[model samples]
Target chain A: MKSLIDICDLSREEIDSLLDTANDIIAHPEVYSEKCRGKKLATLFFEPSTRTRLSFEAAMYELGGNVLGFSEAQSSSASKGESVADTARVVSCYADIIAMRHPKEGAPLVASMHASVPIINAGDGGHNHPTQTLADLLTIKREKGGFDGLTLGFCGDLKFGRTVHSLIAAMSRYKDIRVVLISPQELKLPSYVKRDILQKNGIPYTQTTDFESVIDSLDILYMTRVQRERFFSEEEYLRLKDSYILTPEKLRRAKSDLCVMHPLPRVNEISTAIDNDPRACYFKQVLYGKYMRMALILMLLGVN
Target chain B: MNIDSIKDGIVIDHIQSGKCMEIYRLLDLEKLDCQIAIIKNALSQKMGRKDIIKIDAAIELDFDLLGYVAPGVTIDIIRGGVLVEKKTPELPEKIVGVICCKNPRCISTTEQELPQVFRLADRERRIYRCFYCESMSK
Candidate 1:
């Protein structure tokens, strides 16, 4: 069975097909209302996620499928010490497809290994989240028209932001794509990613602490929150927190067509005032997430 | 003093000096009941110094792991005090349960039952990354 354990699990052709399906769903949502009418979706979220879990639930419901499974590990048999493989084996008997979000990296992968049905990784620790990458790709496609020759800038915590890492991994596969990594020195992109994804693919990227100097050259500016929880000291967090904040003043220096994006439940990294800007596509990103997820759910279930 | 040759077993020769213990531990040579000889820092004509391990009972070695740990080591199979086969193992494309991924967020750390699998990410650099999390192993 096909499962999305990582962004690269889907080829470029598959990604485009998913995007095309998303676009079709956007144009005619009612046509897909009864697509998976008798299907069942199991959402096994071991971690507490509001947006991602809800997104999957919403996508499944929109596809005329019912959703089941626990939102937290404590509420499930996982608290009783059921293994992921066992859980997957049991859950596969109940659901047509499974979307799992776990705090442990590769928990979904273990489930995928044993699951009789297709397993979609909702979120797996700081590792890959292929669905979010799908949403990001759809947003990029809609906002920028195409993936080619786009200069993408990623700001804030690149090291811990799974979204940033996944996006970089996805975009590096495209043509003429350059990345500008904007982060404080404390939250720089991991060297392994730079080596494995960017350098290996020969994608040109520039690292900068200053976001304003390079904002104008970017076609897409992906912003990520730098959590205070990752900091050892309040002082260090405060010192570096505002360095990548997207203020109105900062947006003034960015390109007029620059698409500003954030994986939501954002903190102070993106100023609320920028929501009114014509270039702010983050809200649209949330809606695009739903459509893309619907596309993903359909594809995973082999429902066309 | 000369180390005696094995009669019916395997002799691992030309291991880079100081890499024998790691290879031995990885291969779990301690579990073997057969006579084992470890000659460390032995003088070699080709290499200035080398390590050799001679096992006096025929035992199957994980050649993939041997190639990964010390690529150029020579392995000779002995039967009735005659060298039956001589070969150098090549690096395997994938390695399982050898190097543990140290990434704290990696799933193998939590799942415990998952195999610690690694794939050769860069052959030229001899770099392997955790197959699940893609974290590079040093």
Candidate 2:
């Protein structure tokens, strides 16, 4: 009864197994359709994350499962003073599995404690989003063919991207993964991830404000937006905004095979011109996210 | 001065002062259906500042509230009007819906609809983090 609350919750073998299952599903979509014919996926999104919510719904629908639950807390029973425990107890009666996104940090964990079905954290506050981490892993695996010995570069908003934190957690579990953190000092990766995940795993990583100089060395350039609002002042955002943009001119210097990935709804950190480069995998990342989620919905429902 | 003993209860001790209200709001202690004694600014030799809350009918401390208020505070379980056990909440292994993670850019903070999830990664040193945005506050 393992719940995908965090990336590290799944071991390397388990991740590989999930990837393999996703690959099989991708290879033979028709055979896997209707795998969870009667099951229901409850997407209890307390926050309105249209992208993630749609992704989850699409995954469930494609799996031949029904989708239930609310996209916002204000419209749900939770707004009327129902504790997460009560909501979980009630939702479990209707759904085979639950994927919850709450603005609060520990909402999913609390729900998991009381849920009868396996609980998936769609996204919790600024905390971990295991599924996005899952999507990133699948995209990386499909692009690079494996998870070992690649120089993974994390660019922009390293300080607040839960995706970055979760990815570091997942990738740190693999061997010989060198990390290049390209961000302004204001948006540098938190000490916890750098210390707990990277340093503890003994993964070699270097930090710099410059991304171009190191572009050629990276096998993957992960782009995240550093919003001006995240900073104490616009001056700081302005100072660092250009410090990390992935322009086509910049991509010209990157490894010909380097994968350019962004967890989408991207701001201008990435230029549209670079989207045509075969290395730009962000759009494909979205499709893979859906397919991987389709794999997840089937897997968690025990139909895979 | 001798303190009045609770008949059968839990005593929250070493709470950093000025946080009784946060606990009050957290537990809604005012609406409690049980007898309770709350003493703020109580004398202490070890703690320069301390507060105590004694529940007359055995009550479990809302540990998340405790962790958020003061992570290292000790709690005593009392029975027969005597201290039968003393314990401290280990750092919360996972924090959810506790403190508003201080990161404003955090979806949890901005959404007005999500719980602030944090995991207690280092208990002894009192580290908790927002589960979504990954903001750390000690």
Candidate 3:
């Protein structure tokens, strides 16, 4: 059975195919209104995530399918000490496909091993979030027309940002892509990511603490929040919390067509005043995320 | 100090100096009832200093654990006190239950029943990563 536990699990061709399907759905939503008719999607979220759970539920509803399962561990058998494998086995009997979110890394992988149906990892702690990467890819494709030869600037909390790691891994497969990592010394990209994905792929990249210094050369500025939950020390989190804030003034030297993006639930990292900028595509990215989820569900269910 | 040669046993040679005890502990040599000898910091022309282990029985060994703990070590199978076959353990592609992932966020850390798994991520650098979280095996 096919499952998406990591972004690297999908080949470049598969990602392109998914993007094509998403674009088609956007162009003609009526044609795919009932693509998953009579199917049931089980959303097993062990952690609390309003946005991702809603996106999955909304995707299933729009596909003429029913959504079931718990929103948190307290509401499910997990609180009673049921293993993820057991939960997946039981849920597989009812749902045609499953979207899982857990606070523990690789929980989806364990579920995928036991579940009879396909498993989609909505988010797994600070680990792989393949669906989010898919959303980001679709947004980049729509904005820049393609990934080739585009310079991407990743700002803030690169060390623990699973989305940034997954996107960099996905984009490394394309041609002539460069990266500009902008963050404080404490939050720079991990060395393994730099060595394995960027350096191994021969993609030229530069690291800097000053966001404005490299903002002009970027085609896409991916701003990420400095999540306090990922830090061990409150003092350290407070020290690095306001390291990089994207304001309208910072974009003065940037290109006219530069795409500014943030995986939502922003925490003052992005100024509200910049929302009106024509290049700000974060909200559109959210909508595209739903469409991509719809496409993914159809693909996994073999309806597409 | 002289250790007697085994009659029908196995000889593990060329272990990196100072790593024999780790290999011994991980291999659970203390659980074995058969006679075993560990020669540590022995002079070697190839490795400058090396360790060797002699087992007085032909019991099966966990080659994966051996390969992971002491790569490039040689194993000799003896029959009638004569060497019958010489084997070299290579870095295993996957290791299960040999080492636990220390990453607290890893699923293996929370799921106690799950087998601790690791895969060789970089062969040249001799680096292994937890199969679940991809954190480097320290």
The top-ranked prediction according to TM-score is 3
Q: Candidate 1 overall Cα lDDT vs. reference?
A: 0.90
Weakest 10 consecutive residues of candidate 2 chain B by summed lDDT = B104-113
lDDT tens readout by residue for model 3, B16-113: 99988888888888999999999999999999999998999988887666777888899999989999999998889999988789988888887749
What is the two-chain DockQ of model 3? 0.72
Each predicted complex: what DockQ? 0.69, 0.12, 0.72
TM-scores vs. true structure, each candidate: 0.93, 0.74, 0.95
True contacts kept of 2: 0.08
Candidate 3 residues lying further than 4 Å off, grouped into runs, are B16-35, B40-50, B58-60
Candidate 1 local lDDT, A126-177, one digit each (tens):
7878888899999999999999999999999998888998899899889999
TM-score of predicted structure 1: 0.93
- Compose the digit string of candidate 3's lDDT tens values, residues A167-216: 99999999999999999999999999999999999999999998878899
User: Candidate 1 chain B: minimum summed lDDT over ten consecutive residues — where?
Assistant: B105-114
Best by DockQ: 3
Q: Give every prediction's interface RMSD.
A: 1.4, 5.5, 1.1
For each prediction in turn, the share of the native Cα contacts (below 8 Å between chains A and B) that it retains comes to 0.71, 0.08, 0.67
Tens-digit per-residue lDDT, A55-164, candidate 2: 99988887788998899989999888787778989999999999999877666777887799989989877777888888899999999999899999999889978788
Ranking, TM-score, top scorer first: 3, 1, 2
